[model samples]
Target: MTSRTFAAFLQRSLEELKEQGLYNTIEPLEGPNGPTIAIRGRELVNLSSNNYLGLATDERLVEAAVRAARTWGAGSGAVRTINGTLRLHEELEEKLAAFKGTEAAVSFPSGFACNMAAISAVMGPGDAILSDELNHASIIDGIRLTKSTTIRYRHSDMDDLRAKAREARDSGKYEKIMVVTDGVFSMDGDVAKLPDIVDIADAHDLIVYVDDAHGSGVLGGGAGTAKHFGLSDKIDLQIGTLSKAVGVVGGYVAGSRELVDWLKARSRPFLFSTALPPAAVGASIAAIELLQESRELQERLWRNAAYLQQGLRELGFSVGATETPITPCMIGNEETTQLFSRRLYEEGVYAKAIVFPTVPRGTGRVRNMPSAAHTTELLDAALAAYAKVGRELRLIP
Candidate 1:
């Protein structure tokens, strides 16, 4: 297409989104993403950040980063297989494996890359993946990239999962089968039924992969979802992000020594992409140490989540089946959800609206991520704002 036609098409696409109240404009944050953040010169209670333990700005983590950077420089300079394998990288992997109760661990620059690399490296054209319908975008993309036949089980529906697993196992079309799910669904805050999933996996002799991106620092006494369910030894592959509760930038997969060795040898991302920065790896190690040493932060995080979820429900908003810190205030319709988020921000609460593609078209919501750093006063203030906006929009009484 010519420039004029291409421009017209882009304009039409944007206009369509705007008309449906689905256009998302990025707001620049001026400070650290903490309990409170500055956006457009306004301070708001930050409920959109993934810093669950509030360690993104923790002094110890900062010190660790500074020390590592002073000693090792900023970048890794090459992929892990090359010269990027610094001492900090090995230390971080050892720490992660210990924390996850696994024999070994391998780091990736990002969780998405880890999924892509791990999935594509382990499974391919003749293999099959029984994935959760609500699995993260990265998992879906990774599975797609593997050229594997993917069978999407209904979200958290054991019956659907069993049906799909049975069909896939009995089909005789694939050489191997894997079951993939997020330990905690990011949007709904519900915990995955790992025990049931494990049973199913055992019954079918399938490889079990759990992406505990949202559960690591907040569950299993800070060990993660597998530990939370006391099934650490039973889980095959556990993928987690250092960027979430760990408050650092990177991802890791924890498993048996042989599996980790396989990833280190065959994963393209680990082979081709630069390793995580020295600072990030150092800070992540410190974060894991903190989590393993104390349950205080995790306790506070759950307290805050419970308080906010209860308050919202009392105000008559439908907080979905959340068993974790992610609480979604279900306000149907894209326009209404956007208006709700705008009103909350206007009232000094920085909650974002979830619209189509992130969620189903008519199931738009305002997702609240309550963190350990948010004080009661802050939570109360946010609740008041949510109540006000909810009332104004007739979302609640």
Candidate 2:
């Protein structure tokens, strides 16, 4: 039998969340997660995926995955430190390093795992981390794992970062100091002030770590935020995810050869967890090659993004400070935001409402991710839905 105390605590916590409209209801997709998705047997314009380049459903990637599975079997069969380091894995890493303009790279099972492994591997009790306040949850958790003294500067506020960095450096209390941030703030879609950040890091002699999970495949002709800012050599560590724009599963850290070697030696996830599957590795390699060969997909992605963002703005919906494809129609009240999302779904759009603690309270929104796969017609349909719902709810005049 279960413990009554534990069950009671779970019940109370769930009840409180539901009461506050903070509880999220999961809806399973009936088919492939493409530009359009089917939920509850209804087709809707999909605006909740991170498949920025539509490569997740690309034929070239699918064929590559099939070939890989045929040749390498299903799984890697062990942790990377063991016999799991397949030739295919090495090829993927090589392509990633080349694409990111780095000397070498190390792969992890997921982006979250990459941060967890990399951060804790290099930082410890005597070390300090200066982090952006609005950094992703994975970054926040990774810092916590290190037991390092974490100093949160204002989000993208270089003055605050410089002040904190100088104080941390002058304090002489920590052994190694590192500054970490997201290349693209996923929630707000604003690119990081990387050029300024590199300048500050240069002044303080701090190790610079950037998790360009969203920025990769979308920025710098698909080279990522560091390359977008022409600071690939200046930034110390760069992290990326294959699942987002690459349309596959896994994460990687690219930097100097020494950093890659160090992560391979010390990262716990690499040492403990089983390796990514052959199919995923194969598909990711194809995706990277595709990105390297042409800028057609990136161009399409940006065009669709601009078109949708402009449509929302013309409809008078506030898409807060986004400089990228992630468009959020800001709706302040939690319940109202949820209702708006539901209304959109009813009108055949599948954008989801993001509330705390994904974002701050009273800053709830219906976050829309426009992909290259979405045609102009699909986007227009989504905008029409937005118009009807916004007017019905009196959200727009």
Evaluate residue 201 in candidate 2 and report its C-alpha lDDT on the 0 to 100 scale: 91
- Scanning candidate 2 in windows of ten residues, the lowest lDDT window is 1-10
Q: In candidate 2, which residue pairs get closer than 3 Å at backbone N, Cα or C atoms, i.e. clash?
A: none
RMSD of each: 1.1, 0.6
lDDT of 2 by residue, 17-119 (tens): 9999999999888988899998888999999999999999999999999999999989999999989999999999999999999999989999999999999
Off-target runs (Cα >4 Å) in candidate 1 are: none
For 1-397, candidate 1 gives per-residue lDDT tens digits of 5699889999999999999998999988999999999987888899999999999999999999999999999998988897899988999999999999999999999988889989988999999999999999999999989999999989999999988999898989999999999999998999999999999999998999999999899899999999999999988999999999999898999999999999999999999998899999889989999998999999999999999999998999998899999999999899989999999988999999999989988999999999999999999999999889888887787
Weakest 10 consecutive residues, lDDT, candidate 1? Answer: 388-397
lDDT of 2 at 173: 97
Highest lDDT: give the candidate number.
2
